[model samples]
Target: MKDKRDFRLEIASIESAGDYVRDILKQYKCTDRDMVRAQLFTEETMVYWTETANEGDILQINVRKRFKTISLSLSYRGAQSNPLAISDEEEDETEFSFIGQNILIGLSTVTYSYENGYNVITFTLKEKGTNPVILIIFALAAAIICGLIVNRFAPSLGPGLSASILIPLSKAFFGLLNAIVIPFLFLSVIASIFNMENIAQMKRIFRILFSWFLGLTAMSAVIAVLAGMIYFPLQNGASTGVNEVNIWTQIAKMLFDIIPSNIFQSFLDGNTLQTIFLAVITGITMLVYKGRFPVISKVVSESNLIFSTMLDAICSLMPWVIFICIFDMLLSGDGRVLLSSIAVVVLICICFLLIVLLCLLSVALIEKQNPLQYIKTIGPVLLIALSTASSSATFAPHSMIASNKQGIRDYLANFSIPVGALFAKPFVVPVLLLMTLFVGNFYSLTFTAADVVSMVLLCVILSVAVPPVQGMGIFLFTIIFKRFTIPLEGLAMAASLFMLFDYLMTTGNVFSINISMLHTEQRLREKDKRVIVYNNQKC
Candidate 1:
């Protein structure tokens, strides 16, 4: 199959252009969806050219599939014209063009330019990486099969192989995680806070929305802790190596730790609380004097992007890490531990469902809306979130649903959804809490009430810092485990099972965010009504 192909046809012969492009895409083994998109682009270009081009004008179509990206270019000899532009002169055509433009933008990158007496419209779609869910599933299956084979046929090789290969690989992965933990954590928190503060005009709505975000997250944390303790009870007095301390004393120590006396030492020590504190104060200062510290703001934002990119690159190696870690666990005959991880995944799923249901119920009671109908309206978007495990992919559809179907104010919907996407991760608390308990049980470690309090608080804060990157959630477990003294071994098992939790997390996160928008709108309406009544009385 050729990587590039070109077709030349008259403006009138649009169907031929579509056929040629479709055939070329087929040769490249593009998915049916991609073929459909390509065909649509060809048809759209033809329609646009037919309207604006000379009848005998030649349309040049170039279809190229290069290195996981598919590019389609349609060049026609004409004045500069954007095929996607919607003109209001023709109302019906405008509507059609508007919808067509959104469809093209959703499926691919669309650009228009004049190139040497020809108007060129190009569409490019990057083939997405193998779904992390599918890859991790395959990795788990392969690890189990290979581990059983080694254990049964050559038990003597297990320890030597694990020590020689597996442990080192596992350590290397964690080392990468540890390397980014401090900077990623600090910069992401600062970025989140700084971005939140950057929205100064929305300060009024921000107060209400911010409160709702934290309040709902805190509620989720409580639900997570209670659900974990109730559903998964640990053995009696199974804890080892933890000291008995007064609950008040533990609480005081946790509070005092948040204020770092030495920020440098805190960063070196990986003190999450102190670092978070530093980020908060710094973010607030930047927000207060944003004009004076423009350079500082840019540096924080750029540094965050750099570390986030690094973290994402590290996460791309997760399938291999999952395979190595799970294989290591099975080689040592820790089949029971593997089973425990599956149970934790199930628990996390249930917790997410509970959170979503509770949120919908609240929306129903407070907003006087139909929960079932709301779900039906947003069901497609939720499915998109689940399948992609990406908030970025779901944002457009979700925002459309919020504004068009859910009747949320456009400004509120747009603002709240993006904010929620970045910082409001209500679903993450459950996964963190439940996984913390699983690791604690696996290691026979116990937490006092104070420890649980600290865990919940930290989870809520860390949840804010959890980057909206698919499969990147597992790396946060590196920080979480280190903070509470949980064994790092649990991280490997959690990484293997994170794919399942991630799907649920993203879906629930999307759902909870929509609910927050609805609730925020409702509260604002009530506030407006109260203001109206007060004004009337004054008059």
Candidate 2:
């Protein structure tokens, strides 16, 4: 594919670049929407290059299509003028340019690198198949029909057809997603912690980090409160739970289990936080002894290969897993509840994007960078994040987006991305609070302002403490449900009902991590330059 589309054209002939790119899109027979987007992408890349190229430089562009994505590459030998890099004086820009906001942030993804003497900019256009979406719709529609049939015929069928068949199948497939969750968490956390560069960068960025998070956390909580007001209407009905549960025992058990008695047993029992505890200890030990034992460090560095292979295999079956999960849920005769719950969950998720965009654009304006372009290169990372709902799993993809696409310095990218993967939960608290409120209404539980504040504070603390594995949001919410005296029994139903929103929340987490990494690195770089100049003047 690389050799097939190789071309050499003089700078004078660069006007035809978009036409050349359009031909490739035509050959692939992409949708009209995608074709127009690709054309726009090519035009932007051309403008960036043509404005910055030197007198003797030549422009070489390549067009490649793989699976469902198209990569349009523009390589030119020239003096490096990275359009993405803004000057220190420009850092004070109070407004972000929205000209290519969509392409930058979401419409398409663009990455730039300097190789040898050539500047190579690659644009990735992700095509969503209407066919697959339609198929998904059909699967959902099929679930509804199967549900109606099963509910109507339960009297005639002994033990029920769905009970004997579909339910088990659905649980089995869904369980596969959870198979790699713990190991992936352990490997990623351990590997990230042992990397000394990560620690050093964390120290440099620590001061601003808290304030940044504090702002995002407050915004998330505010968003949840507003969303609750709109969606969680007060209902007068019988209380959902009879209040028979003991709160202290549940709290003590959850706290005590965080430190497992046996690490091996914890893995066997799928204890996420306990596994995280063991991994953190191991990572710190490895870091301390890395100089003395090179062999240990070497082996740990290679461990990601094992987990990556496993995740790829498991996540490949995700579409089918989702289909089965939805089918089984419908088959249980709660189709009406499940569908409505999904709609509400989806609304809060849609609202989450606003908060993410607000954070990203705000950072971009202050830093003098384009938010659209920043978000664009991060598309692959966010896509993987959404699919896995595990930052640990998406670490590899995020690393690539950071170094190759976004041009984050190697040390900072390695450090900040993993740290973000582990500790970042910008949207988790708000979304979880919204879920609590939404589900609370079903149980006729009205949340006061104090309850909201306590919930948000707990969420902020828990998001950082928990292993960034799947289902952990609901796990935290379950504890909060107990604390707020909301009845522990309704927790499972809330988890089941609002599972889909977790994917969106995780995606937002990774997205903000990338943005935060960019902002932090830029500030540190500028700070270093200032110190150097100050020392020079004193000398």
lDDT of each structure? 0.73, 0.59
Query: How close is every model to the real structure, measured as TM-score?
Result: 0.75, 0.50
Misplaced by over 4 Å in model 1 are 1-127, 232-241, 291-295
Cα RMSD (Å) between model 2 and the true structure?
11.7
lDDT of 1 by residue, 28-141 (tens): 666555566667778877786777766566777777666665678888777877665444455542443344334433321455666688888777654445667788889889
Worst 10 residues of 2 by lDDT: 91-100
lDDT of 2 at 33: 45
CA lDDT, candidate 2, residue 31: 55
lDDT of 2 by residue, 256-283 (tens): 7679898799888766657778888988
Best by lDDT: 1
Q: How many steric clashes between backbone atoms does each model show?
A: 0, 4
